[model samples]
Target: MTDPANPLVSTEWLEKNLATPDVRVVDATYYLPVEDGDARAEYEQEHIPEAVFFDIDAIKDDSNSLPHMLPSPEVFSSKVRKLGLGDGTRIVVYDRKGLMSAPRVWWMFRVFGHRDVYVLDGGLPKWKAEQRPLDDHPVLPEERHFTARFDTTRVRDLNKILGNIESKAEQLVDARSAGRFEGRDQEPWPGRQSGRIPGSYNVPYTNLIDSQSGCLKAPDALRRQFEDAGVDLQAPIVTSCGSGITAAALAMALDILGHRDVALYDGSWAEWGLSDKLPIEKGPEASASVSTER
Candidate 1:
């Protein structure tokens, strides 16, 4: 409880405030295609009381070729309004896999100008372990007016990264596994080659998380991880993962450190990896572009 207004909330805090009228809980669980798991099926099975399932894939821009790309302002507003999530609503998002995909939803809210959102620390696993109330039925949401003011500064696309790589104004942080970042492991997704965006640093999303409790690591530990990966805290950062899901975890970690200029590359490696034209780097020796420029 060091940061009461922290981006994350403990299950104890959530249980105490579960019945608050203005609080809306979201189950933002998402699994990779490799897992062959269904998020909706898991949410339907059991989730926090008063929680509604937020389908990460479904709520995204359908017109986008990449997976879970951010929707337009109108689309986001409409989808959130349907979920009864408004600008003023206090949103608490969680995932079944502890600290997995909940941060993505929290980041989405922030990008859409909803500042009062928090990710559930330890996520559903901690809540379940504590035997907190669980509801099998999804609650019917009353429609609410949600205004979405999309912030371009909080996101980066493929084209933006293309321009950024040359200027060396931003640090590219890859949150995928070391193997993936080193191009030694095959991607979970089909047909994509295994390699990281050139000049990107690897600090796997799992590094920021505690596996045992499903909670984020301490600030000092997170700082060490980023520093070890050669992330210069002073520079602006753009986070990327396999499909942009885990990248939010890195963004959340940056926010916790009070870094103001952190952004998520929504296209992430999903788009960049699949593209034949984009430059890809391999092995642990691959370094950030800023080094060469300096």
Candidate 2:
């Protein structure tokens, strides 16, 4: 059920339509520590004209110890308003390495009840490679009212995740790579466990995205991808990934597939993996037994 009006846009489409008054381009780039790239610094160096940098790290819930957890509705509204995003604006978000981090911002807007948002396919890399346009000029945006409608049902806290695990009320989906999900590879974060949450399915975020195009796959294609990975579309699903980044990608995929009940585990592996008391299952058995509970 991909929205006919709001499907992911390509670099060519953005280049042509960027000048539209209602369109607001945002550089939603975020880099991993392993990459050693500064997202804000890169955004400042060069970006799409009038595209402001949306700091994913800064708009997080500061009260939580976990990394980049979703902020409260009030906080989110204030931060987005400062960026010139409002109810009437049609947002187009992009990241440095294509589909890496922009989907998180796309999902954030949806969480706040904005449906006019989309991710820029192929991101800055493709845009620069195609020689579309780039501007180093700083943008000062006028303030506007961005109504924040916090959908509590779209988010799952630690307690809700624990309860879901115990009650088997929802299917848990992990977007980490197969190795990380199975504990065969170590976590990127120090002292964090490698395995996924109990009874979680593994559908790496990479699978849902086109490597070359950097856009999400078509709806039928996405459906098959999830089914092939053993995900039950009809069941309630909660998505998780390392530090809650890629988990948002999973949530975005579900959104395009018309799965409205999907919830994101904000703490994700950052919180769950670091706790010694939490159960950790190793090997492919963890992935194999996914969705066994009805």
Candidate 1 off by > 4 Å? 1-5, 284-294
**Which residue window of length 10 is worst by lDDT in model 1?**
285-294
lDDT of 1 at 216: 95
C-alpha root-mean-square deviation, each candidate: 3.4, 3.5
lDDT of 1 by residue, 1-294 (tens): 225347988899999998888889999999888897898998888889889889999999999878899999899999989988986788999998887899999999899898889999998888999999997986898989998888889999888888887888899999999999888899987878778777889999988888777789999999999999888998999999998899999999999999989999998888877867777777756444212211
Task: Score residue 235 of candidate 2 by CA lDDT.
Answer: 91
Q: Rate the local accuracy (lDDT) of all candidates.
A: 0.87, 0.84
Candidate topping TM-score = 1
Q: Candidate 2 has what TM-score? A: 0.92
